[model samples]
Target chain A: MILLDDGCPDFAGEMGEKTGIDFNRCLQCKTCANGCPFIDGMDQAPNRIIRMIQFGMAEEVLKTSTIWVCVGCNTCSSACPMAIDIPALMDGLRHAALDRGVEIPEPDILNFHQEVLNTVKKYGRTHKLEIMMRYKLKKMDLFSDMGVGLKMLKKRKLDLTPSRVKDMKAIEKIFQEP
Target chain B: MKRSSRNLDPGPSSGKLKFSFFPGCSLKASGHENTLSLLKFCQSMDIDLVELEDWNCCGSSSAHSIDKRSAKYLPMRNLSLAPRGVPLLIACPSCLLRLKSSFLSIKADPALRRDYEDFFEKPFDDELEIIHFFEIFNRVDLKDHMEILAGTLKGIRVAPYYGCMLFMPPDLRYEKSHTGIIEKSLKSLGADIVSYGYANRCCGTYLSVAKPDIARKVVNEIIFKAMEAGAECLVTACSMCHLNLEIRCTLDNPIPVLHFSELLSMALGAEDHKKWFPRHIVDPVPLLKKRGLLA
Candidate 1:
């Protein structure tokens, strides 16, 4: 029940421009799908997303959980017979999805990424504790993972203080730049 | 497998191997023990690591996935921070990929190089060698210390969980690789390598934070597989993978996951388990003690 936008017919070409990967070269051999460890969590296999881009199904492809669920592990791209950078493709799609203001199938993942960048923007490095607390605050369901959080604290896996870059002006400039 | 491994480059000039080290966010903030043991191992091997001054994030998976510009700038800034001539050694696998791929891109394009130089207010050194910690193995021969280090790791069974480090984008496919470097280096150190199916399985990184269920599933599978393969402990090459493996596994009595550097430090006769082992959720001390690796 999805219709291709005859307007942006070269969606694959557009993605290639964004990620520097030629999606048209994908053989659709399912090698990427077979090797992807997070395939079960992905609503669609990676190659299907590539095919969607090829067919100009931008809305469908951008809205899929596959892009957001991908941790950029590079399992598929490494095994890709066509040698396509599948993870790079996912990154491109996720950016595109965010840019275009489409519905994100995995809002939690998006929230996590935002929390991570938020800390980096502030401290010039990631603070696991802050990222977690901020994410839980935003999600407003922190108690669910309290056990794991407590465990990490007990093991000192999550640090109370962020190891920051000495020159805040430098990182401030990078984050502020257009 | 179509993934090709490359021959390693020559070791550094005889005595002291000094280089700039970027410990990325994972090690810098959370994995202090990984940093400590890594420094210990490097010192024992006479590898002097000068930490990169004011190095920022490497555009971790989160950066590239959300904002393209932040991703480019993060790694670009780290590149600008690298000292000239001496290679910049990144400790995290993901950071290595992010920085290395960006370096290759800047190297491949002239205009982008100028833009990067202009933005960062630093010259892009074409000769600046960006390397991973594994690359140091090519320069240091563990066998040379066998007289003192022998029998230190003899009875320990380790599963080397590379966890997606080897399976990077094809753009970097032809670059120098560290495939089987862990197994090769550890075997020479006398630890038994236990082969497992899930050694290369992705540890479901940020998912452990966002989608714990999926991360939990994959983590348990990896740990269970390693245990099934008779591994007494796991040696992970990545800090995030080490964290995820320890935290996400829901199995009862999971094996201790040690950083590759920690194991190397132990085998090199660096007796500092007290500093490193307590940080681990699953303490490797009991296993190391049982194997006579500790007094």
Candidate 2:
């Protein structure tokens, strides 16, 4: 299912245009994969994703868990000999994936991200407790990390109330954009 | 990110240095000990860090990962709020990346700067200085404040875990980096830094909650390596790393994770360990007491 399809030949070039990075410079030497701390969690080695992009396998690359699993720590980009902005490439791919409404390989991660944005939209800042609660509520799996949540609460790490900004109009102006 | 040529303007004892501090959500909400200790450290060094008033989140990982527009605007809003002619000091590495990259982007592109100005309804100040907490060290030597030149943390052994601080994105390669500042600073304070391979390893951030299994494995590995290398404790620069390392590590007899601010304040004889120590999940008091660093 993950094999290459030559239908989207413009994928790599378009990504280059979007991110201002040249994927052609990638040596495929796997410097990024080797340096990535999250490599174990990814389905594809970071290099393979680049190869997939170069081959115009847009759907496969978009659907892969590697893109979502990447936290954009820039470990790969910094270590890259070709100086390819691999994380930027990933961001381009992610935005493209969302635009196309493709099947997300990692929905929970996306859900978590959405929840964080939701908090920021409401308060003009991230409310960790609210984000965590809503994220767990959406998954209907709140019990899994209850111990860690309680520990954080006990430590006063998670605030009881959200830190709000007075300029709601300014926050609204930012979030109201398409 | 170029360091000012005048790194040594006035020593810590001579005058007060003022910086508009941007304590990201982590330090503001969850990392009480970190904030308390950090403020204490600044007060002792004659450095006055004024909080950025009504400052919002710097888009964080959420904005950039999914929403491009929000990412651009979130950090831009914070930039608009920056007071004229003063350095904006950010403590979180992730927050720094978001805000600094946004600043650099606007500075390089006149169109983006115009858009930012038009959006925020304020004129863009290109001369605004955005710096990190570590930048304070670059401006002064902590030894000036140390009454005993022989280092305050003489008996404590610390493992400085950077966790995604040194390796920045390509766009920010030219920015001033904090390479070895942790080890160098702590060493100057008399703390022996343990050598470990996983000091630069990623702490698996949000994954600690979304995919705990994966985060668990990585956190355990990092802790195990530091402990294996004879580190009595681990010190981190980011509050998120401190949270993830403390929460996700399932290993037996885990070493305490101290914020860099805590160690710095302690070494400088702040005498407020009682307020900070109880907040830690893995208490450093027993270890510090055993080493005679804390009584």
Q: Pick the lDDT winner.
A: 2
Candidate 1 Cα errors over 4 Å, as ranges: A1-8, B1-14
Error of 2 at B8 (Å): 23
Residue lDDT tens for model 2, B1-295: 1113146335446556878889888888878789889988887886767788788988888788899989899999999998887799999888888899899999999999999988988999899999989899999777787657356787588889988854576767898878789988888778898999988788998998778888999899999999999999999999999999999999999999999999998887888778888888998888988988877
Query: Lowest-scoring 10 consecutive residues by lDDT in candidate 1 chain A?
Result: A1-10
lDDT of 1 by residue, B146-197 (tens): 6667666976899999888655766577788788988988887788999989
What are the runs in model 2 whose C-alpha is more than 4 Å off? A1-8, B1-15, B147-149
TM-score of chain A of each: 0.92, 0.94
Q: Residue B221: error of model 2 in Å?
A: 1.4
Pick by TM-score: which candidate is best?
A: 2
TM-score per candidate, chains pooled: 0.94, 0.94
List model 2 lDDT by residue over A136-156, tens digit each.
Answer: 999999798899999989887
Q: List the residue pairs that clash in candidate 2.
A: none
Instruction: Report how far residue B162 has shifted in candidate 2, in Å.
Output: 1.3
In model 2, the Cα lDDT at residue B145 comes to 79
